[model samples]
Target: MGPESAGSAQRSHVDRLYHLPMITPQGGRRSAMVPDVEVDFGAGPTTVPSTMRYVDLTGNGRIRVPAQGAVDWSQLNKLPECITVEWSGADRGVVEAVAARQIRFLYWHDASGTVDLTGTGVTDVRLDGIGLRSVRLPESARVLLLREPPESLEVDAPESGHRMDLRLFSRGPDIRIPGGLSRVSELWLKVAGTVSASVLTGLTDLEELRVSFDDPPGVFADAQDLQAHRGLRTLQLDDAYDWDPGNLPELPSLRGLEINGTRRATATVVKARFKATDVRISIHGAKSEAWLAAHMSNPFRDWVEDSKPFGAAACEAYTRARSAIEALAPTASDRMAVAEHALRGLIAALNAIDAEYQLIDTLRREQAGEVFFELAAQAEVPVDQARRWFADRDF
Candidate 1:
């Protein structure tokens, strides 16, 4: 047996220890450093004067570029740059300090505008970031930012050909913003830490996507599976126990996916396959029935649900405990005194049990069946033996 096979029996540990690509600083530089290209930026260009260099103009921040004649932030490099300016605060009369970091610009192809945002010449403006809320281009129209807790940067513009990169500080990972993104192909999300979004619903043509989050400050969902990315060929979802991502992308053409986290991505059931593999994948949630079928080479594999038995058991226990406590309600008797004491005890115990299960989910991977394994581990028991597990699952 090779190193992969020899490690099979210990896959439970290996499954938790997934392998992901190490992002280099140079990789991040692409998104950070503003390109030095010289655009003719004709007379009408929303251009930046030579004096608009990076400066501590604000006297309090790292870098600031004050727009000269209607600042065109679209010319910025594909990275996180803080646009330090001022805006109206909640109290309209108050002058609020505004810093649009992780801003994005999208080519407004629909209703075109003029050189300025007044009529029909300035539609050339393009900004698209998750943290972007209301940025009126020309003056303060180009940059966007998440509401609170700063994030690094994430640009998912697959068509832009921009690499999956960003300038991340030690504490980075999430950017909250508006939903419904179907037109703009360039996607950027800052799940810098855990203060972020759960599902990226709009990018349908995406062939590959990589998400990085604080392993513990993860986001959870009600039911949407991420693998729903219709034409995705690659996926990388990593996080900690706190990261509660719902479903894995249910992609059929997925050639590879690299994942890391505490909870099993609930959406692992969509039938999918890949052209090949590069970075190893580590799955822990309810892996899709179609995935095993492809891996085992037995397209007819009957798969089992990989829900955490511990979680279910705890849930059932809580239900029973609640019913029992409710039964002792002093409704039909004059035992109101004991009822109060009993009810408190029941509530406390139920809460304690719930906490216990949550800890288990954090400390280790949810237990799965024998045939199942994380994508990261190498095949050991001949690809055929694994295929058999899928066939016998139904019976």
Candidate 2:
């Protein structure tokens, strides 16, 4: 697939497309050490004026250069706090020239052809565009980002104690997370094709993960079986419904789940299944009450109507409980009296039942213990009794 689609285009083009004139800072000497410079590029020929306008991005010690065509930063020998270069043209000698500046942190934004970084000395670099050649990346690289998927990727870096973050949007076949990418703590992947779960198998130390699939049928059929990534704390899934529900791996540290493009009904059911897993789920998009009711733990008349057994000695009790629970809001006169009374009677009938209902067993088996506890609390009954009632029999 080419970059013609809306979702698959380069991020810079999607966000900010530069068409203005390029500005190259020019100054012979300064009294107090010059910290940063802002360079902007246009479509015309390269012009290095003796003086140019100064623009600040973050209002700090960082250089923000947005330009086109070849760039030369060879004069900057002293490393600044940070350097950001945004260009749409590739220059084979630009990396060597920038290396002479001894940059500490670099933000390279390019949309043209590939640029080589064989001997660049930047400790942290965020490479943008799709033509990045990783073989030339220095071993001193600590933080890296392929803003877009690369045609050729080479994993080379020293064994430093620093943790790295790798973010990329890739739809290519040749790109793969190199096994040598050690100490990677955060990984963000936006994919468009089939990918295996094993790509993330060895990333045990990963703490944050965000994955989005642009394919309609979903490409991560193999990624559904998450293989015990205990360190993962935050997982955001976008348009990823290829994985089967109820098959998620046990993540002890996982606490936040952000999901998009998943049906609300499925999200509700899955959230109930992981209630004991203690994850805070945030489902995006519109939601309906029907989806919410499908996963409710409380026994209702609907279940009885569906030929599902309820723990009611009298059918009227089940009917009453169902009506009470389903009511969106009670009238000011009745308030919750109708539902509360129905619940008391329903609990009494349930206590007298000797046979077990499949609904209760299903709730317990799915680890939706809190739902029952909430029901008990709403019914003015003890939670311990509800827990014991749920634990009474097996399905």
| Candidate 1 Cα deviation (angstroms), residue 325 | 39
List where candidate 2 sits over 4 angstroms from the true fold: 1-82, 88-92, 100-124, 128-133, 136-142, 147-152, 160-162, 173-175, 286-395
Query: How would you encode candidate 1's per-residue C-alpha lDDT over 1-395 as one tens digit per residue?
Result: 11222223333343443221211123222432444333221123233322232212221232333423333333333223322222211211111111223222222211211112221122123332333333232322312222232233232222322222221212333343233223332233435345332445554545555554533344444224555555666555544334333244345665665544333333332223322434335453333334433322211111111224433443443344334444653454643434333333433443454454332221122222221322101222234443443233221
What residue pairs clash in candidate 2, if any at all? 20-42, 21-41, 21-42, 22-40, 22-41, 22-42, 23-40, 41-67
What TM-score do all the candidates reach, one by one? 0.30, 0.48
| Model 2: per-residue Cα lDDT over 240-340, one tens digit each | 54455565677788888877545556677777877766788876532344522342222231223212244223344455565666662534456446545
Q: In lDDT terms, which candidate is top?
A: 2
Error of 1 at 316 (Å): 38
